[model samples]
Target chain A: MRICFYPGCSYASTAGYKESTEAVCQKLGIELVVIPDWNCCGATVMFGENKLRATALAARHFALTQAMGFEEIVTGCNACYATLGKAARLLNEDAELFIKTKDVLQALGLTLDRIPKIRHLFEILTKAMPDAPSERYRSLSVGAYYGCQLTRPHQFLDKGGYPEILETFLERIGFAVTDHSARTQCCGASHAVIYKDECRNLSARIIREISDKGAQIITTICPLCQFNLDQAQTGDLTPRIPVTYFTQLAGLALGLSATSLGMNKLLVSAEKVISRP
Target chain B: MNKASKPNPFTSISDIATINACIQCGTCSGSCPLSDQMDHAPRELFALIREGEYDMALKSNTPWFCVSCYACMVRCPKEIPVTDLMYAFKEIITRKRTAPKNQKMPDMYRAFSRIIKAKGRITESYVMALYGVKHPLDALKNIPLAVKMILRKRLEPKALSVSDPESFARLFELTEKSEDKA
Candidate 1:
């Protein structure tokens, strides 16, 4: 299956998740084409200020992907996924919004048809990864974290509170999934920089809660969440559980090595696990 | 206490979804990291908004302390989008200029926004430099703390830099365009 990928800003800097995702996709014989000159997702701020403009900004990506002849765009960042998903849903449901946004984009020599299906990377894997092991993943316990953006606002994807798509993906990859309460908890997100102390408190709380649930290393699809959780482990009291991009884990499951998957580059340090299996 | 109360103040179309989803479960207040630092609870603020008590809610510091983590929204049994409501409350506070007397936080976000308005994106160095210039005391307090943390190797200065300057310029233009349209 071929899909247009929007990596956003976080992908370039997110450990080796981007590289691993590409490598794994190549190995899996699935084509991952990145949208060139992609702009920001307008996360949190865009929709907060102007709904139409933000939707237009998001729709431009979808328009470009559609123009490139891809029916779906897979996003690695939860904020991007959520923003694009919300925009697509809004554009499809609200005609006036679609018209206004389309008019704005037309000013820049771009015209949007319909918003493409915006799928989170995990969703694509869940749909693509078969039941039987593909000789990549043997046996591993994977912890899937769904940050607030991916599931909130009562929009597309799974129900707001209880989401299962991500969990189902990990299981298919030959991993025992941990069922934890903080699955839907916040990871400090954009607030990580502004409110350091408070953000740390919340991030550390989520990390501890996840670690307590016996997750050796937590895996997430969001770049911001990974960065915050990885950066929050400041002391020895906190068990330095590393966070991995789901694609990076998928890269490993797809039989990619630690260095190839950028496992050695993790901020929280997954050196111990990289040596395992 | 008289049970007779006025209509809710958060009656705007922008706030109806948020207000409608509020279950009055008090989860937001309980989960708020800065609940102790604030004068009232997030639940109380929502209740005020739900009941159209905008004046009272708008007068409080509940809007300022929100870190925008959406923890309350995540934990809310009713799945209310609380952070957006908090953002609405903050925009109101900004318009009223009745924000907390301590101008540090708003000043910080404003400075960040100004960087976006000027450079078309946030400049970490510029923000840090501006932080030093505007609040020399904060800079002075932070320098020693940052130095100590740096020496301890606890802090890795990952400076925020935008990849495309032209795109950021376009973003600034877009911001201006939206304002012009408005």
Candidate 2:
């Protein structure tokens, strides 16, 4: 019930991912020890700039996690999870890159003696929370959005194309899960910021698909996915499904108040849905 | 390490070998969600590379259009690591400064990299501001959303730096030195 948390760069700024995660973890009796002085995971931008630097950026976190005496590093963002995971895989497979990264870390008075396992916050929560169902959220139907980068290119958790882990978790926790084809679809990732019109269409497609499947609300595991989906709904997107983090729903199931879970941070507003029955 | 023995950090032979194995079966193109936006689909990019048309491959908007969803990478019939190959293409484009004149993605990447290089962390507002300097109209369009985010306390204009600034600075310097040697 303890984890070494890496909140990533956007954790604090992304729509209650931080607040809900903290509240949910605290209630679940999970101790979150944040890595001290952790840097950015460089997301998808760094590897395109320089492979060695990108690997070192993520490796720095690995060393920090080891310093904290933890074998795994848990992060909430899909980009961070994939970035760190990709770095770890590269270090393990490529000796030259590993040595180069070690040299970089050594210069900073740190050592990459062990590569820590990169875990998604969702994985940790599912493992820690008991499967005891509660009737509090049984009436609320959710469209589980996994975003890209969680399971794809690394099928450790579930099938990449159509993942059901989120649904299984939701059903186990008492919320009704909706079946949708947009589960592993891309939310335009970071490109949504630069290419607004195009990325809006991309995010809108996912939202439309999930809404058409009769989902009352959409739940996202990644902050960027939630942000893109929520913001895209602003301009003429129909149904206006509230995009809430998985943590927010889990917090509600744990008997936390809506305001305490940061549900108010959502743009489309989950008020009506959660306030029902 | 000797020059011949040392792998090219930018684009390794193994990476090319992986792309070389691509059968041009179009599974990658079909699987890609943003293929419609790219000038050349993932399958076509691989074909271009195999034909020694490196310039065309680098110049294509295909790589920049990649959202790194890895749908192509996972579903490729030949397992060509399509996503990573896209990253490799971006690196080559960046190093060569050959990004198309109309492409804003390279500039966006530059802005993002600059922030992380300075503060050891990214401030979303700062990134948007920096990127905005180059594209005022795009930034202008986001004002409404930005205001809403600010009101919700989700976007902060102030930047956040790592707790240990000195070591963070040193890490970059040493990494750059190592890259220079490579």
Candidate 3:
């Protein structure tokens, strides 16, 4: 099956997300056609700054993906997936906003005919990955942190307060998904660099929240979330739970080797998770 | 530390409504992720808003880094809409140079604005490549990591694949028209 893909910015810079995601897809035999000239999903700042401009910016990509003959657009970045998803819903809900955005697009000689379905990579894997195991590991409890981007803004997908997409994917791979409050909490996101101490404190809250709930491993789809949570700990009081890309875990469960899964590049060191019997 | 007493910041508005709704129970500050890092509590943000101290309210860093997490709104006993107030403050603060001194973030915003002004959309590859160009050494550091993900299909190069370039360009023209009209 083929789906239009938007990789966003962080996928190119993150540790092993790119490699492991490709390997897993190849193993699963799904062809991911990257959308030609794909652009940013307008993350949070865009909407915060200019709703009209941000909606128009995000809607353009959706329109392009639909034009490319794909009903669904799979996004690699959580923020992008969420932003596009939110924008699509907003445009659909607010006619005036839609017209304004449409007008903005029309001058460019394009129109947002429809909003394509936006799916996170994890959502795709859960639906697309065949049940037959490519590999197996001892049963482990994993924490699925969906972050604020996916679940919030409430206008898109499953549920607003609690989402089951990530958990469902983990379960499909034969691992147990843990229930935790931190699943939707802010990990201090883009502020990681500007407000390191604040970010670390907030990230620590999430790590402790997940760990307290008994999740042995933490898996996510956002690179910034992964980086902040993975690097928060200094000496003592560190959870030391390995933070991994959902793709890497899928690769491992799909029979790909550890190196092929990009295990070496993880900042938090997934050796703890990978070394498990 | 000046913990003895505090005024409400939200009271100055024509509506003293949401101000009285606050219980002064510190629940808003308790739920805020950045509260611990701030010099004044979010509850204090409300306090300042009530006292007509708009300058003090707008000058604080407490409003800039909010993460927009609606925990306070969710748990607020009075349904005070603390997050919305914070958004208003953010808009006010954001316009007045109250943003965190993000050396790269401003560049990021400038780049984003340029993309919207140029093509009406942000090209992921273009943004990354440009970001890399601006920070060559740092971008270079990401190369080895990028190369690894690219081979795995997790990371894609900007030149690899794109949507219809013609249609994409037309979209940019539309944004310029809107700007002219605006």
User: Chain B TM-score for each model?
Assistant: 0.72, 0.87, 0.57
TM-score each candidate.
0.79, 0.95, 0.74
- Model 1 interface CAPRI class: incorrect
Which scores greater on TM-score, model 1 or model 3?
1
Model 2: per-residue Cα lDDT over A1-277, one tens digit each: 8899999988998778888999989988998999998899999998887888989999999888887899999999988999999999999998888888998888888878989888999998998777744687887889999999889788888998878999999989889988988898888988888788787778888999999998999999998999989988875865699999999989888888888888888899899988892
Write one digit per residue (lDDT tens) for candidate 1, span A16-35: 76777877777777787878
- For A1-277, candidate 3 gives per-residue lDDT tens digits of 7768887756665767778888888887878898766666667566545456667878878777767887888887777877787688777877877888877777765657777777777777877776637445546788888776665554255564677878877787767778988787888876664455446677888888888888888998787787667767655756788888888888887778878877777666777666773
Instruction: Give the best candidate by DockQ.
Output: 2
lDDT of 2 by residue, B1-182 (tens): 54345433335434767876777789999988789899999889777666666667767999899999999988987778889878877877777788898998888888998888889999988888899999888788889998999889888767999876766877667766444211
Worst 10 residues of 2 chain A by lDDT: A128-137
Question: Relative to the true structure, how large is the alpha-carbon lDDT of every model?
Answer: 0.68, 0.85, 0.67
Worst 10 residues of 3 chain B by lDDT: B173-182
* Model 2: DockQ vs. true structure: 0.59
RMSD of each: 4.9, 3.5, 6.5
Identify the runs in model 3 with alpha carbons over 4 angstroms from their true place: A132-135, A155-165, A177-181, A208-215, A234-239, B1-29, B38-60, B70-182
List each model's interface RMSD: 5.3, 2.1, 5.3
Model 1: pairs clashing at backbone N, Cα or C within 3 Å: B8-B51, B8-B52, B9-B52
